[model samples]
Target: MQKSVVVLAVLAALAVLSSAARAATDAPAELDLLLRGGTVYTGDSNEPVVGDVGIVGDRIVFAGRKAPAQFSARRTIDATGMVVAPGFIDAHTHANADLHSTDPRKRLNIPFLTQGVTTAVIGNDGFGGFDIAAQTQRLRSAPVGTNVAMYVGFGPVRIDQLGEANRAPTPEQLDAMRQHVSRAMCDGALGLSTGLFYPPQNFSKTEEVIELAKVAARHGGLYDSHIRDESMYNIGLKGSIEEVIRIGHEARLPVHVAHIKALGVDVQGQSGDIIRRIEKERAAGLDITADHYPWTASSTRFSAALVPPWAVDGGREAMLKRFDDAAVQERLRTGMRENLRLRGGPETILFSAGSTKYVGKTLADVAKASSADPVDAAIAVLRDGDLMIASFNQSDEDVRAFMKRPWVMTSSDSSLGHPRAYGTFARKYDQYVVKEHTISLGQFIRSSSSLTADTLGLKQRGHLRPGYYADVVVFDPARYAAKATYTQPALLSEGVVTVLVNGRLAVDAGKPTGVGAGQPLLRTPKAGSCT
Candidate 1:
């Protein structure tokens, strides 16, 4: 009897082993890459789970608790003690400046890649080109380092139809403008972007924008705007918010606020009010959202910061002509003085780019050195050339308030001489997520990735789900931080250990791989819209 029992046990054990072998053989083939032992945020959850993520070709094959024992990979990254999440998508950027460069190195987009941004939206603040197909073709021919999506800019379209004119467009011109927007939408533009805060776009009335926005809406595109006023410049911030809501309602399209902020002392501490207004609009069923960078200072042309919009109506030469007009001088100065006061004071504006002599100085410093009034010094600087200034206008309280909102996403609004170009994501993580605990890591990742993607209609990206694109980021949370500052704007971020764009490593072991794996992401127009 004992001998019989032993034989039965031995046979059962062999049967179990054979079943396990069959299961292993039936499992999917080896993965192309495996990220082992990391805290993973799937971009859909506000909580993280410690797990392994497996990829095959250009798609994620597994992204949960330990990838099965049967799964293997050709390349494996020991992601121990790291945070693995979907690669961040920048809601707004000026990366097109470099992406369009002839030099391959410039197209590498190392600044954004090092910050773990695998995709960036271009043509923001109303500057995208009208020819979406031409732009896509150029990007395809000379690939860039990060995926590029574009908006059909209101500024370019309006300028093309009306040459810096402040008056309303003629009916023929309006129809022509509508055709331009429709063609761009059919050619894969995400939406219409307008920097209404800047001239000549500021010259466009709300009704004109609504007409164009309607064209984009018919083709299933959204409206993105740098609202007409972020401060008390024209209509107040609240009025601008209402304007955006009205546009959404009138045009019947979603509206996105770009780099939303309570700029200037006049609008300081009004972020709460702005948030309430946005929420009210949202509750009223208008599709409205906004993006913000993680800095108190806002960057823009020196002239845009101080010069009255009416003075810049025609163009540079026209504006220069006004500067020489004795009749306009006192009025210009008066307007500038009020603008300067609204933006804190002369000391709060730092000249970031343009004249070498003034690049590192404040408006106050320049005024003092020139022995002139601050306004006069500003005019002198503008007359020479418009410099980029970093105006320290927002309060931390307002910044945090905007950030805490679930509707607000992250953006760089990147431009030359601004640290945000290199470090917006990292800075947000370091300051808001890590040190201050203003938001959880998962919240930060979600806002920077999936939220932006969903809002902008970027398909098949920004998540860590099976069958999703393998654009992933692995970083040392403890070490991940922004190294760039206003003075050192070009310094790269630190601690982004590995980055993959389209399943290829763009940054490996914290060093860029020099692989331009980026592709132009063109939105397909609604069915039959192209035809």
Candidate 2:
């Protein structure tokens, strides 16, 4: 009897031990995935550092300090020594071209993901191509490395309704344009963007823009503009700014200035005045916002650099005819000289998407070799291709000044144009935030993630909170840097190890896992934005 009692006591002790162990490691019921380790900047001022983030289905349920007791997940990621923040939000992009021209997801998204960007806003500078329904349909069907939002092309809308004439639309045409805008918004455009600096859009006046913006506003969308002037041209610097501010007031819609800049050494130190205008307006509750790339060089088409807008009035065929005309050619050269001065110098210019042979060469070199004037060299390149070039016109002082503002946010100003498109986020971290120490890690994270997501009204995103979307990035902060340059724009960024979009692993273990798990960010009626 004594021996039997001893064995029973031992067995009871064993059962108790097992029960205690289970209590300590019990799984939570709501989690499909769990991320544990390092530090999490939740973007929530309250509980920024959470030990574990619990995911249920697609959304996060718990993100505070905890171990799973009643819950179990199909997968758990050990994210020790990583900073999991919201995915970087690109404020402006031409990636819309990417979706239509090719399978958007099949390309090298590694450069973007490696820098922790999971969402890119496409359609800027007033141009998004035809066939909206088909494009959105493909975006939904195929899947992509990041969430993509689109904007309707104001330039195309103008062209489709009215040719490239320098006049306001007729009352009937205006109504038709409104209908087109309505259809585009219905077809899932987040807002409207106008490249007013370009030909067709430049022809439009401020009143017309206000009218178009009213259409966007009615559908709960914002108006974003590549302003009519970035230099001391016909409208002048102050005039261009007033245009946007006036639109905000006149149309009662949010206005976003796309790639805001005061181009040329002539206006180098005038950014402060622009900032003051924005601040004054913002304080008055005017919905105004802007974004800037970290680099000093601005990138765009070569045709824009050479030919006068008037000559390009009839589109490519007419423009080419004028290009062949000697008198028009003289006018083009004169315009190029004036424009080139606005763009710093030829050496500061770096060619991007063009004949690969001309990619890194400057206008000076190309001009010298071709035995032609630099302007003529640029025109020739454009004749062969609508080559994208990066003009280094921005000042370091101005960039730093812009960064100092709480209102100014970071942007790549990058399209699939070149290094900026791929290397923007990495460049921000490596060049400005870490290497230069211009901003803290928290500031950098906020600028790239939460601040950006908030601007777009991404509910429950851009934070490391429980019940938030599981869009996360893991990277070593110290080693992060951009590798791509004018010479090689396709080079992937370094230091990012893992990236998740809506609980799906688009990038994992420093490699793309072949997941197209991004979701469309629909426009909320009250919080309209540029897609």
- Please report, in order, the local distance difference test score of every candidate based on alpha carbons: 0.90, 0.74
lDDT of 2 by residue, 2-21 (tens): 53343344334334555466
- Model 1 lDDT-worst window of ten: 6-15
The numbered model that scores best in lDDT is 1
What would the per-residue lDDT of candidate 1 be over residues 1-531, giving only the tens digit for each residue? Answer: 653343344334334555457456544456779999999998989888999988767777668568767666899999989999999999899888799999999998999999999998998999998899999999999979999999999888998889898999999999999999999999899999999999999988899999999999999999999999999988999999989999999999999999999999888989988888889989989899999999999999999999999999998889889988999888988999999999999999999988897998999999999899999898899889999989999999999998988999999999888899999999999999988999989889999999988888888899998767789999999999999999989999999999999888999999999999999888888888778
TM-score of 2: 0.89
In candidate 2, how many Å is residue 329 off?
Answer: 4.6
Q: Can you give the lDDT of residue 237 in candidate 1?
A: 94
Runs in model 2 lying further than 4 Å from the true structure = 1-27, 46-50, 64-72, 101-108, 129-132, 326-330, 526-531
> TM-score of predicted model 1?
0.95
Give lDDT: candidate 1, residue 331.
Answer: 90
